[model samples]
Target: MTEYLLYYWPGIPGRGEYVRLVLAEGGADWIDVEREGAPDGEPALSDILSDTSRHHLPFAPPFLKHGEVVLAQTALICDYLGGRLSLAPEGKKDRRFALQLALTIADLVAEAHDIHHPVAAALYYEDQKQAAARAAETFRDTRIPKFLGYFEQVLKANPDSQDWLVGETRSHADLALAHTVDGLTYALPNAMEAALEDHRRVRDLSRRVRALPAIAEYLDSDRRQAFSEHGIFRHYPELDA
Candidate 1:
């Protein structure tokens, strides 16, 4: 068995890709449980989530099962794996700093997803088209600039004066940021094109991450699932403007 078993829905990068990026960079021995497990991925995930016998049951997918540990939420999972895989900075405070950034990135991701499903996640896009368009305008004009610019300033103001997001080296936070940038650019091409022009450091950091040997290889592999309408960063034409 692989050292790590990742439970996430199949067919879309979604929140799971953020976890995947750190795993790729760290070269951790891991497997996508649903993709490699039984054909009914949801049932398998539910089995684990609903396992009352387990003390640590995750409420949703994108959880990782390693040994007797089961971790949910992207930030927590990345923090755990990054530490074990040597992708974390030393010191307690610095690790918390990385988590802080990861949480912010998570906030941005949630907002992006809500753009397409502003009314309700349970409602279809067609049913919420008008609300989504309204939401998209604000997201493209406000939220994107806010989150991306915040990260750019964070890189610029790194006390260590390094290109990485935390301390003097790359941590899980940087990987999360890189994946967030990719998702944003994919979901909002026109807006991101304009937004990225001013956030040069963030853009460069993402580029550097993508150039990492392991990350580049994983990106080129068949395991990499491309962004789609079903995922968080859905690219709706009306929402693109």
Candidate 2:
């Protein structure tokens, strides 16, 4: 069995957490490259990403290397790992459904990040504080509810009805949603508290994912990274409702 190598930024969970959950649950033999401090730090991550030799180059971090294949993008990496690790939904239809769900979850994650960096990714939150506040208000009022409501309805509409987001079994999408929920709660506690109440199914799904055996252990382990200012989801009291 070829051990998987995950290339993600050090410290914060970010998009890598989504892929980490799958690897943890599946008991995959994987190594978190930069986190372990082997070759170097962010430089190694950047070099691998900019490597011109590879025809299929990934645009960013959170990419997974399996043998010669380098898969990037949180959604794509999660989907690829899910299937290989037996964490994916069975059959052609469910597989596509899970992928779509993961993609949708990614959209929500991006929006959550934009709340703090509404103007530009390069500018610090301090420079864009005023803009972030305005953007966050709309995000809390409209986007949060819309995305959470969609996930809630999706769970209710799932034919499996076994608490998983996609099919009966837990898939990459479910894991990703759980991670997103944790981030949202950390970043916008006030908004998430009210939204979670209205979205019980989604809440339960996130809880269920957290309660999984491997995940429970992983959460308590040193490997599990906490939510902070650097990650996609960030807490700025002024931005929250």
Candidate 3:
């Protein structure tokens, strides 16, 4: 059994949370390298990202290292893990559909993050408060509805079951959707409340994901990081309607 090593920021649940959820649910033998400090005292995440010798260098955090393969991008990592952990559908088409849905959720996550840092990721939210407010308005009004509504339709159209996104069994895409909804609920309570009113299936899916045995335990454990200003989903009152 190859042990998985996940490299992510220590505090705040960002893109890494998506990968963590899948690993936890699958009961994979994995270590959060950064969370569990290295002997050198150097930040594990920075060490991996800054390593010039690696042929495939990730430009950011939330990368997974399994044996010699170091994979980047949240959705891509999830897709890879989905295959290894049986969190993906059996057939090729279903697996591809699952990846498609996961990527869509990733897009939504990026948009949500952009709401607070409209000007640039490097710039502080306080510096771009006015721009953030405007960006947030568009996100709450147009983007949330568009993405959430699509998920609702996907659930309805699922030939096997209405609960899971791809097939009868829970996939990585479902976890990603659940996490995205959790973030939205945390950051934009009022906006999410309105958006979910018409999305009963999506709401139910989120509830189901939260109720999973491993997921429930993980959520209650110390490993589950809290939402904060430093994370992708920041609960700024001004940014939220």
Candidate 4:
């Protein structure tokens, strides 16, 4: 059996949460290396991300180490894992659609994160409060509806099933969308409340994703990290509608 090692920031869920969700749903044997810590008390996340000697160094956290293969980027990691976990659709076209949906969810997540740090990710939110406010207004008013409505259409158009994003079975795209919706709800509750009222299919898919046996169990467990200001889906009161 190949034991998987996930390298991610210890505190916030961040992008790593998506990979964790897939692993949990697949019942894969994996260890969150950063959370566990090293035997010598060194931080695992920093060690791997900043390893100068490694040929394929990841620029950030949420990288996965599967034996000798180290994969980075959230969508790419999920795409790789989807094939192994059978979370992707069987057909090639459907698999591509699943990946496309997951990538779109990634874009939504990036926009959600940007609402708080509009000036720059390196700068503090306080330093860019004005810009963030502007960004938040646009995101809440326009971006949310556009992305959520697109997802709603995708669900409505899904021929195999309206419950899942790709086919009759759950796919990685569904999990990604669920996480994105949850993040949006956290970051912009008032906006999401209104948006979801119109996007019934998107909302229903989110509920269905949550109701998955493994997902529901993990959500209730301590292993699942709570969303906070430090994470992508930050709940800054002023930034929300």
Give the top-scoring candidate (lDDT). 3
* Shift in Å, residue 171, candidate 3: 0.3
Which pairs of residues have clashing backbones in candidate 3?
none
> lDDT of candidate 4?
0.88
Q: Give candidate 4 regions above 4 Å deviation.
A: 38-43
Q: Could you tally the backbone clashes for each prediction?
A: 0, 0, 0, 0
Worst 10 residues of 1 by lDDT: 36-45
Q: Give the candidate order by descending lDDT.
A: 3, 2, 1, 4
What does the lDDT come to for candidate 1? 0.88
Per-residue accuracy of model 4 over 1-241 as CA lDDT, tens digit each: 4377889888988999999999989888888887874444333777777778899888887899887788898988898888999898999999999989888998988998999988889999999999999999999999999998899898888999978888889998899999888988998888889999999998988999999999999999888999998989988889877
- Residue ranges of candidate 3 with Cα displaced over 4 Å: 38-43
lDDT by residue (82-146, candidate 3, tens digit) is 99998989999999999999999998999999999889999888899999999999999999999
Q: Which lDDT values do the candidates have, in the order given?
A: 0.88, 0.89, 0.90, 0.88
Inter-residue clash pairs, candidate 4:
none
156-183 in candidate 1: lDDT tens per residue? 8889855988798888999888888898
Task: Note each model's CA RMSD in angstroms.
Answer: 2.2, 2.2, 1.9, 2.0
Candidate 2 worst ten-residue window by lDDT: 36-45
